[model samples]
Target chain A: MSGASRQPNGSHAGGVPHDDDGVPGPGEMGGIPRGPEAPAPRPPVIHALRDAGLAALVAAGLFVPLVGLRTDVGPAGGGLILRTRWADVAILVALVFTGRLAMNLWSAFRPAKRPRTALRAAQLTRIGTFVAPLFLGFAVLMPLLPWTTRYGLDLGVLVLTYVMLGWGLNIVVGLAGLLDLGYVAFYAVGAYTYALLSTTYGLSFWICLPLAGIFAAFAGVLLGFPVLRLRGDYLAIVTLAFGEIIRVVLLNWVSLTGGPNGISGIPRPSFFGLSFSAGGEPGSFADFFGLEPSPTHRAVFLYYLILVLALLTNWVTIRLRRQPLGRAWEALREDEIACRALGINVTNTKLTAFAIGAMFGGFAGAFFATRQAFVSPESFTFIESAIILAIVVLGGLGSQLGVAIAALVLIGGFEAFRDFEEYRMLVFGAAMVVIMVWRPRGLVSTRRPSVALGERKAISGDLVGEGHG
Target chain B: MSAPILPARNAPILQVRELLMRFGGLTAVNRVSFDAMAGDITAVIGPNGAGKTTVFNLITGFYKPSGGEIVLNGPGGPKPLHATVGHRIAQAGVARTFQNIRLFPGMTVLENLLVAQHNTLQAATFFGIGAAFGLGRYRQAEREAVALARRWLEATRLLDRADDPAGALPYGAQRRLEIARAMCTNPVLLCLDEPAAGLNPRESEELAELIQLIRAQGCSILLIEHDMGVVMRISDRVVVLDHGVKIADGTPAEVRADERVIAAYLGEGDEDDVPAAPVEGAA
Candidate 1:
């Protein structure tokens, strides 16, 4: 990481004569304070003005098309046309100019020798103790709130499903240090398993859930075996290929999967054997309980079901991290050669990581299927895998709470940007870049030791190497 | 594997008979053979690239010997390690540390020891599914593992730093932690690849004491070292290697006086009768 700070100086090294790297060294000319090359510090006002001007120029260049222009259909439905919105562009540029000027002034007047933000490990771990449960409470109580609209409940279900997926991938990418780019293959497998079994064989969603997980785990082990010898980029490429292969198979195997059209009208989960049907039908939840029938009960049931499943995933992952196999996987990530030297069966360990990670992916897939009442090839695209991978990584690998919060923030934030139309991805992408630059290891970068002897201290992420395995 | 053999007195715990390793065209270890007895600190000292570490690697199953056999006489009798799978070699009662420190830097000191005992805990956890639920047998197994790690940590004097990351320790402490980790595997034969490679005199003295302690516990040792101060003091026997073959083997004092061992250390011709080997003390 110390090596990383060099880039900041390197970017500005074109004109600046960095005598001793970037850090100002001791007085060079026999302890003299100032040399001929040194210039007196400029006034803060002038500096701020120059910076704002440059920032306005750069902002104008950056927002060339999207800023001042709006594209829409002509007055009628005749043809497409462009409408210029110069005021909006000017406002955006002015905001950038002011922001840059303020930033320049702040830096110019700030005290010297300030502490950096590198002490985040201590603060984040301290926050994790309370932040995790506080978030859980809010999530649990969300649906019951009177203000939570039906759309809000639906979005909660979506976010929780992703949270589950993020945790599942955390086992492979975060814990085991295997970069799996094709995790959605397992997701697709689960969805299709539930879809095909329920639609064709008349199995209940409950029966197919476990079966879906088993089949996906089988797929995991299958994929794991051939790629056991691969590591790093090779493993990622192969897994990415596996995900694509699954999607292609689902697309072409139309009789089994409905091609691009997908399988629909899949059964929703019941209150046990009782369906959540309206009009008080026989064996329906309302009829069995002798209560008022409302569709909200079904939505609440699904929310709680997914909440339970996500918690289960979280619970299982925490337990596994302290176990021998979990330790072996982590050790393998730390130093595979050392792991082999210690008599660990690397193949079995790696396989189990993949299987378990895929197993959860499978469960989440089943949930996605039942929730949507649909299974389509289009839904299990590379982007889903990328988003899940992004969630796992951006959450800080192996940190469960971090992954949950990251999923919520990312999914909910993505949804929040839905109104931005095509610019949503672009804006979200810029946010991700800023985040990566600020904290490359994810939001929860400091890792809590799996087990501790005394008062637990968070291990700095710098100490641990990514499990290139 | 069954535990039936009770070795005769002075028997070789590890017998390497004409082990040969060839990587493409280079003979890294060529037809070398030596015996490490039941309770001895046998040091293999040679110049750089003299196949000292190569022999350790071959014995540890990092490489399959091109020919001949390497066997360790555990409580289960002689197990041929040459043909066993790479990982099973560790299970076959042999453990080794690298020339460079290879501690899992991210893990706690105790966790490093715990990982070495994974094959044991893994079975007790029923392939670890039982562990995810914190079920019956796994809890006991993990407790036993922690106790075992505690023992090694105590032995290596790392108990105080047990909670610290392995990488955060001082260099000498990391070396000790690596040995502690290797010992946690419960090996009958321990191979130390330059165990004292980067230690100060006092630290090396402490390392020699640790080696003696490991031998006292009935685990035989095979070490590659350049530190003659350590070798001359603690090693019961020394095997000198030159260009991939064993040139001399005997008590450290006897090997120290051998002409070829001197030549290997000094090159071809004599330099006015000066002692060539950095033997502890010689004017």
Candidate 2:
């Protein structure tokens, strides 16, 4: 085909409109009258009614059996007594109708010209830069706050662990564009490595931590090799299978692992050579610091330790994003065929992303085992993997700061919902829906390009494919 | 007539001998062959479904040839590319652009070029150790990489848009940027697929000059084009293919004069069914 044929400009040389066969051409409509002038667009009353009716039906189906009718047995005679909670059913139906109506109104009134990049992206980045240190300061003082309870410090440690895991998965899913649905397997490896080593050989947490990371990274390499040729859904399925295999082995292999009951009594990290223990022992941290023995001391130490580790994860990730390997990962994510055409060793780039990401996950896992003083297969299930993946996704993929904020908000928010008991997951699902509809590209939609020609400008996340994640 | 075609002053930088590509029963390419002399612009032109792109794929190592040899003359020895993988072929000094522009849309114009120099910059990173510490050696290499990127950017007149995402640039600018990105790899041979497909007259003219500029800088170019005007103006040699077979290969003037080439382009009349000539390159 000629080059001009491909032009989108809608022009063809030496062309004339014709109606030689007496079929009226596009510009020659004479017999039919044009319809009335366009009516001003009306509010979607019918659509709202339809939506409310559908919602009401769903509400009725869900709430009718539970709230609409109730049966009770008579205490003495064994006769049946029935009671109906009509109010509960009405409340459920009303809530559904109101929610549907509100959604319709919001959609109608929402601004039409949504810019690809949010206008407030720069402002948000500036605020993030300003608030980051303060956030870190708050984290550092969280355990020391006047209202700080043991639960607060424990929660802090949990949130930090997840934040670290999110950052690790972000390297694979975000930067490198490899969809890994089995990241928790690496975490399991790290935890088990420390548990087995410490329990078998009496090695300390400090010694096993790096060793755990190495083992996890090695596991990552093993996973990377077989899945190198797979992409997108295939890669995800294979990784998910790998994670399940690891958990199943941990569950069934009772000799090395403790089976479903899990390995317990894993040692907590000591303060270098000084253990955080009771009494005035020469080698105890409390004795050396001349302080009274308190469990809070150990809790506070773990908080700082995890905080440092999470920050290290963030630091290394940020540094790598600017390095050659990091750039290669991003490039591989953007267009793999193009990356290969550019002479990048795709196998190596993918492997590095996997190994480094798993290394961080392993470190977090080691900390987890020590924090709980136990290792279990249940802790490394597919759901945990899903949560970390969700954090990376809901945090706007490659944005490091986004991952931490997402982890804290999601994990801490879930923990806060403990009061709701059975309804916690329901509320969690609703929050996820609302957040996705509100900002589909996650909380932060701007990603700073790895290198900039002039000033470093953040690109709109909408412009990026979630790296096929 | 069966003697090998050779450039007068220098041996060919790339030679394709009887390259055959088949898909099941369909032979998309049938023992098609040609040679690209060093520092010259060779154009491959054919009608739709002429297996022109299949030939390009075979040479670039995107597809393994069904049979026959594709070789690159290197300093050390002949590099048999039919056995090499796509990335290794690129690393062996052959870089190519796709028919549809495949610029890394998410990356900035500058990052696209930086990625093209992945091998060199990766070495400087010392497997990421040197970069992790911001070592002097890695930093110097990075600086050089950036400098090389800027030079190519300036050459393509895309220095102003270096910070802009490659996808956001206008179509013509993206085409130029793709060339610049390929150049950043410092390729010995640049294969461009339809570089002028969507360009206006002015842009195509600019593209012709750009090809000349790249050739003047000691690189060889092999382009696939449907635009005869572009092919006629810039190509030192033109290879004509029809129905997966090379009908003519020679200087532009020589191919323009061949009867089979004329029959291929302008549909053959009932009285003028010219038999195809053997593959030949007039150096």
> Over all chains combined, what TM-score does candidate 1 have?
0.85
Pick the TM-score winner: 2
Model 2, chain A: how large is the TM-score? 0.83
What does candidate 1 score in Cα RMSD to the true structure? 8.3
| Candidate 2 docking class | acceptable
DockQ of each: 0.32, 0.35
TM-score of 2: 0.88
Local accuracy of candidate 2 as per-residue lDDT tens digits, B1-283: 0112223425788899998999999999999889988878999988778998898888888899999899987444579999999899889888898888888888889999999998998888888987898889988998899999999888898887787777777777888999999989888889998887777677777888899998878788899887777787789889898989999999988987789988787365532343221111100
lDDT of 1 by residue, B1-283 (tens): 1222435548998899998889899998888888998888889988778898778888888888899899888878789989887799898778999888899998888888899999989899888777777788888887888888888878888887877778877777888999999999988889998887767677778889999998877788898887777887888889988889889999987986788888886355553343323222111
How much RMSD separates candidate 2 from the native structure? 8.5
Q: Candidate 2 on A253-295: residue-level lDDT in tens? A: 9998989999999888898778887565778888889898888
Q: Interface Cα RMSD for all candidates?
A: 10.2, 8.4
Candidate 2 Cα outliers beyond 4 Å, as residue runs: A1-40, A43-96, A109-119, B1-9, B268-283
Candidate with top DockQ is 2
Q: Where does model 1 exceed 4 Å of error?
A: A1-124, B1-9, B266-283
